[model samples]
Target: MSNKAAVLVAGSWGTALASVLADKDMEVALWTRNVVQQEEINTKHRNERFLPGVDLSPRLAATTDLEAAVRGAKAVVMVTPSSAAREVARALKPFWHEDMLVVHATKGFEIESMKRISTVIAEELGCDEGRIVVLSGPSHAEEVVNRCPTTVVVASQIAAQAELAQDLFMNPYFRVYTNRDMVGVELAGALKNIIALGAGMSDGLGYGDNAKAALLTRGLAEITRVGVEMGANPLTFAGLAGIGDLVVTATSRHSRNWRAGFMLGEGKPLETVLSQMGMVVEGIRTTKAAHAISEKYQVQMPIAAQLYHVLFEGLDPRTAVEALMGRDRKTEMEVMSLETWEQWHT
Candidate 1:
């Protein structure tokens, strides 16, 4: 297993990263729990379920064993979805070697504890602050797999860790930037999806770009407020993981959160939407968690609050919009951070 790095997981994003690394001629092994996916990557060179129609490099080997994935590896990337990050990290703790530069490619906070993915990796994997790096931004799996131009952020307490990840993941099309605000990067990544869900709901209701634009702008305001209160640097939210991710996820058709919101706006039941979309809708669960975090910090998040009621309390989306519209008049800046928009009219 002597290699530049071994990826401890393989999903669309993971496979895309593997492809990028393999392009660099970096020896990388990808690990997956799905035997079928491993066979597909090894035999056919494509992952049909997660990354269809993309041919992966033969240099990128796939495996199912965790120990084999990490043995003699200089670095490791964990790209599983957020819900599975904790269990996977916990399982990998015994095999992880000291000095392994562990890069976390997953986003979203833990639902139960509202902890960010990097925190979960540090806690569950027994890694110190220097060992964990989070890579994020407006990267969609579809675009990345296609080798479309993309940019992302690498955040870690240690500059060396960030620089290591930046050196590995940066490419002509896929650029990587470094940041020290892990809290802001992780929070921005998770909270933007919540707002993207609401944006999709607005589209499902046939609301025009005006409404969707309003949601995106206002949603970012609340995200920044919560980030500031939670000890995240406010400027980080103004950058890639914050406003950058919000724009893409909220607008892109590839976004699962937006699709879920679209279904909700079209009057589909939550269970129906969930069943149709086999993948986990991270934002639907994150809405509840965001609402709780907002209350804990005394930060006002009206969009998240309404979304929480809509998704959980069975409130109608239209009525939710009306409630938001009919709330008592306040200065526009009080409710949102939009400086260029017209004041809400009665």
Candidate 2:
């Protein structure tokens, strides 16, 4: 296979992935919305705003014209922030062809539609499911650009598409796994960001490792519950997209979601924290959508509920924590148990 591909990216993650593709001898076109970013990549061979200090390969170039960026590309790897995924997808529609393979690296649910990035792509592009792929895992953009060993999963119902993406992007520092569980994979990736927000809040609250661990574990349980109810595979949550992503996102300083939660935990207003981060924190919005989804599905999502209150209700973070602590005790596995499942349906 020729090492030539195009990547649509607007942030550090995009730059990092572009750098990876270029390193693998792929002729990568890195698209950006900002003209200054395009100049930086073309002139300095560095992405000053995103992946600073890392030298990008000469094989990679940058552009802002959406049509020019995607023209004639066999594959399109979208790394725009989740909040902008739909808008970007809409903008790309007129340029998209049936043969183009689209891959998304964003990990968040659209708050307005409660749709995953892949779904947003499909709806916007009017494309078949086989043409879209999602790449996710325990990866930090900062680390990935630095050549840290990372593993990710690529999910698509069409094995050929997934395998094509895997072959195109995989390298020694980056390992790729494939799965057919698109819904489960997408849901696992999007929902984990919400849980990571809670985990970061726990740390900001000065909670111990046990608290963080408990939150992470139970957060996975609830995420799985919601996913299973929504027709996703239960086992996917136990795999990379689920547990793996949750752990990395909840703990990493490089995670914008975790950082946003940490700020909230420290008593900063959501608006203020957001202004300081100056980037889209998918978890904040995902918390809202996840809570709504849970309510719609009649699933218990205490973490998402607490997070929503902290973010939107103007409730004190400490008070939110107390409320969660005061909930009536029940078996942790009750939600996932078959007997309880039968009881719910009955």
Candidate 3:
């Protein structure tokens, strides 16, 4: 009921969301550890390193003191990259309380532990995981900051928690939908980045739309397979967080995963590609986690497996593509039959 909210970190997406809240007339305090970045945001209303040429809302303020940012806020939005999520949540513990709404927009698995971002945050906060809401969909920071029409979905095991996120962030240009399948929503958002990287790789290798289309189609199947095995509803894969997110992430030039994949396809070494990115390309890390998850679940994830070899085992991208083309054939329904759906959901 307080119009005050806090956003953790000032990355591209984090800054964009802060702007959204500020535009809606909320007092938004964004926390960042970098003193220079904090001054730039507060003084110039510009975050050139992240959102170039975009004017941040004047109502949005940046702070170097984490407690000052979080102490009185009614809501806290966690937008740190997946790698830093646990550490950030740990730091917020002293200032965080159950009365504050916890929502996260981060989109990746914890590569080392294969844990979802919300899980990591909940563990650190010592609260029920259901109290955390996940915000996800086919959104890019560049588009959202420009006030482009965008729709996103929020999920929580608890309906009221999901509604809390929906009410806080929804606006005319930014539409929010609610769903109860938190597991499906979180997994879909994270896994789709891996396919986007492959899509970029296909384009970088001079492949046509036909190849990309097939890749996207099969990639969704792979994502749904793993997600269902991990307690996600199969039908959730047909919704926004699933197909909608997959289509946008794999096709958009704004996708960090796609850009990194293109570089890898252009024959740059993984180390060089990462150095050139300057920002975290989440798909690279998600690929590693997906590899481990697929093995742990005993699910076949051909696209993710080939990508892992290329990324970590020094396999040529072309050879990886060739191996995929030569894999044993099976009916498309082998993994997606109506029976499969019934079995997964039941």
The TM-scores, one per candidate, come to 0.94, 0.95, 0.98
CA lDDT of each prediction against the hidden true structure = 0.87, 0.85, 0.93
Stretches of model 1 off by over 4 angstroms after superposition: 335-346
**Candidate that scores best on lDDT:** 3
lDDT measured at residue 30 in model 2 versus the true structure, 0 to 100 = 87
Score candidate 2 by lDDT.
0.85
What digit string (tens of lDDT, one per residue) describes model 1 on residues 1-346?
Answer: 3457787678777888888788777888999988988998999998888777888889898999988877888888988777888999998889787778899878677888888888888898776765799888999988887789999999998998899899988888899999999888989988999999999999999999999999998888889878877777778989999999999999989899999999999999999999999877889878988988987877789999999999999999999999988878766556333331232221
What digit string (tens of lDDT, one per residue) describes model 3 on residues 1-346? 6889999989999998898898789999999999999999999999999999999988999999999999789999999999999999999999888799999999999888899998999999999999999999999999999999999999999999999999999998999999999999999999999999999999889898999999999999999989988889888889999999999999988998999998888999999999988999989889999999999988899999999999999999999999999999877855554555787667
CA lDDT, candidate 3, residue 51: 92
Clashes of 1: 0
Candidate 2 lDDT, 241-304, residue by residue in tens = 9999999999989999989889988888988999999878888878888988988878889988
RMSD of each: 4.6, 2.4, 1.3
Candidate 2, residue 42: lDDT: 90
- Model 2 regions lying over 4 Å from their true place: 1-3, 337-346
Candidate 3: count of backbone clashes, pairs at least 3 residues apart or interchain: 0
Best by TM-score: 3
> Comparing candidate 1 with candidate 3, which one achieves the higher TM-score?
3
In order of TM-score, best first, we have 3, 2, 1
